[model samples]
Target: MKFEFADRVNRLPPYLFAEIEKQIKEKKAQGVDLISLSIGDPDLPPPPFVVEALKEEVANVKNHNYSFSQGEPDFRQAVAEWYKKRFNVDIAQDQVVALLGSKEGIANAARAFVNPGDRVLVPDPAYPVYANGSTILCDGEAVPMPLLEENGFKPDFDAIKAKKAKMMFLNYPNNPTSATVDKKFLKEAVEFARDNNIILCYDNAYSEVSYDGYKAPSILEVDGAMDVAIEFSSLSKTFNITGDRIAFAVGNKQLVGGLTKIKSQVDSGPPVYTQKVAVKALAAYKSAEPPEFLKKNNQILSERRDTLVECLGDVGFPCEKPKATFYVWVNCKGDSMEFAAKLLSVGVAVTPGVGFGKHGEGYARITFTQPKERIIEASERIRKLFK
Candidate 1:
């Protein structure tokens, strides 16, 4: 007999970034020196203290065991403390669940809250995981709310009201789009969730990667938000610990408990040493200022953003400068995949926006994850093609 795949898994769309990675590898195998601005994996090393903590914890025999399903108390307390300091929101330890990553937390949360055929509201040209997780894992329906440039990439509340969705996924300093939400919008979102009896799942992974005079706001910052929202955060972008696979879910106790229970059934907890290291990492975050290296990195990115805009402008493909995050969501003149394929031939790897959603068809996402010099070189190469 032949093994068969689950129908839900079979129906899922191809992972776009994985496809991009495979293509880039094939090109490099043939000796193409590709400058990749496709994925937002940070190139910078994490803080020294984070490394030291991991090293120290790994040597402790007690830390080698499995951690609590909910999380170690100290780690939960540390997360609570960090939220108090960073977002000025008070959270109890019971309201938190340690996750392998924010992505896992999101998928698990969708599983916990959504029943089969339930309606899930997702932002268009937004992160693909939200819709895919809901549709494939939870067997729920995805109602895409188109995010237009005219609305600064925010979904219209009226549109959401019309859909009568049961759950909504939101991410600010949003991936692919790099759009940030303000206090007024957040308050409105909280109200919308409360009025509609919807569960608001806020992805806060990029909160700490913000630049300029802007700070990324958390959904929990709004009054009554805790009653209807659950926020997921990761150490990936904040501490450059993507490989560590440590993140947390914080918010409504009942919701957190639901995800924790589901997590217990599917997977064992994160390693004890990792949680110990996370405690140290979060503690270090309390008094730590943004390092000069990141400031320098942002400066380099700022220059690259300007240069790319200027170069693309000359090519008749203009883009807006994102205030925070390291992505430039560019409006490609025609089909995004065609534009990306043409650029790839010139040794520049970019992500086609259509991979994100239908609304992303005319766009492409360029990351500033490459080195400064490579970015400038890529810009020059792209410029030559259009000129």
Candidate 2:
């Protein structure tokens, strides 16, 4: 039987990583020993304490039931405490909503706020979910706020101010570009959102993944950010539990309420057992300093980042060592897809920049999530091919 997808479903762009996975499969089927740097998934295991806590939680039969759409009260409190301790920002339980993942929270937040024909300000060369997964699904027009290399891969607020939009999405310690921002810039974002009455969706998923004494800030750290912004943070990167699907949205009670309402209709919140484990994970933060587990994790990632960047430069793909995140955004200097294909042919896979957005056309993003030795191996493969 033949069937057709809805117009909105048809309008959705192909998920980029899905294409990468397909390529990996094809290469492996042909006997290639592919080293994939295409995805940001962490290769590290969750902390031992997290695993032990999960074991304890999973043993409780009471945790088998569906969780509140708003989240378990203790989990919300843990989120609030973490925000306070990490950012010195105050967050109320009412202002927090647990999510299966920040991906879904972001999409559902758009559902709660965006209407057909409404315009959303999205950064070009960003995580596609802000545009494809959220704005387009709501039939909203996505105005590209290009993050040009000249501007340090940050949106031109001057250009952004000129356009009217109902919402804007910004991610720092950013995914594809690995751009980092400070409170001063976040203040500017808050001011822009407040002046324009735009709902700012701040993706802080990579906030805990910074290196070299650089720390990422929450938009809520800015005064009055709670008036117009909601921040999404996930334990996936921090605790290396991506598959556990534990994340939360905080700030602006009304906005949180709206997202919670949307989630209630669509699905239950994150698993109760997972939330219990996440509570233990969040408890590891007693101060502004990251826990020992995270410090050690970041140290390893920093090592890998250094090795990959140096090797990429050696292999004719010169790029800056990003201060944050596990990605190196290489200047392909040509067609990104072609560059990625060349790497794939050599059994090293990286994400094509064009798959991210039009502004990303001449670059590719490589992840340093693998061990340092593996990263060196991938770069050696590239060096051989490029030379």
Candidate 3:
């Protein structure tokens, strides 16, 4: 019997990371030693407290059962308290929902709100999941808003005001671009959402990963944000527990409930043990200052960012030293994919700009998640290759 894939699945865009992984495997098979600065997975371990908390929770038989669909009560309260402490914003337990990861929450938020043919506004050169998860997977229309260079890779909100959209996705400490938004911009975003009656999905996953004393602002810090926006945050990037899959969606009770309804139909909820671990992690964070291990990770990432920027500059690839996130966006000038292939062949892997979106064309992104030594080595290889 012949089986046809669903139309939605048929039209799915190729995942960029998969292609990068394929090339990496091919090179490894041929015995080429590759330094991968392409993927953004954090190289640090979760703090000792996080591990101990998980271990302690695993011993409790109660934590082995199915958790609440919204979130465990303790976990939700922890999130609320953490938000109050970190961002000086008031969030209620009722407005919080547990997620497998911020990625899952992002995709599900689109699924919950988007109807077929409804328009979704998205920034180009963004995390693919934002546009793809909202528009393609949900059978919605994608209105591509270019992230202009002059605007520092932020979409022109004024130009988009006339466009009718059911949802709009924004990220800061932005991925691919590595730009962070100020509170004024966030206040403007909240105003835009309120005026347009659009649901604002703010991805704040990299909020904890800033550099050079730069602090990323939470959208909830803006006035009226809770009335118009939902913020997604993750311990994956924050505490280096990417594999642990613990995150939460906070704000707008209705949207939180909508996502909860969709989640109930799809699966039970986040793993009980993981939710327990998350409760501990959030409590530990809000209770005091960041641990030395977490601070050291930021310091190391900052040094790596500086090294890559300087090295790339010496090789004629001028990059603005990113203030946040682990990625450094570079202009490759011509045929980003071709240049990426050339770099890959030389055992240095980087993401092609075009792989992100049309706006990302002629640019490439490198991750600072690699060790400083490896990043320096990749930069040296790039310098030698280009020279």
Q: Best lDDT goes to which candidate?
A: 2
RMSD of model 3 against the true structure: 1.3
Query: Clash pairs of candidate 1?
Result: none
The sequence of per-residue lDDT tens digits that candidate 3 reaches over residues 48-78 is: 8888988988899988788889989998998
> Which pairs in model 2 have colliding backbones?
none
Candidate 1 segments exceeding 4 Å error? 161-164, 287-300
Full-model lDDT, candidate 1: 0.86
Show where candidate 2 strays beyond 4 Å.
161-164
**Tens-digit lDDT track of model 1 for 80-147:** 99888878899999999999989889998988888888899888998888999665578888888888
Which run of 10 residues does model 2 get worst, by summed lDDT?
A: 156-165
Cα TM-score of candidate 2: 0.98
Which ranking of candidates, highest lDDT first? 2, 3, 1
Among all candidates shown, the one with the greatest TM-score: 2
RMSD in order of candidates? 1.7, 1.0, 1.3
In candidate 1 the C-alpha lDDT for residue 233 amounts to: 93
What TM-score, computed on C-alpha atoms, does each candidate reach? 0.96, 0.98, 0.97
Model 2 lDDT per residue over 1-387, tens place: 999998988999889899899989999999998898999999999999999999999999999999999999999999999999999998889999999999999999999999999999998899999998899999998888898899889997877654568999999989899999888899999998988889999999999998999989999989999999999999999999999999999999999999999999999898899999989999999899999999999999999898888888887778888999999998999999999998898999999999889999999999988887888899788878978
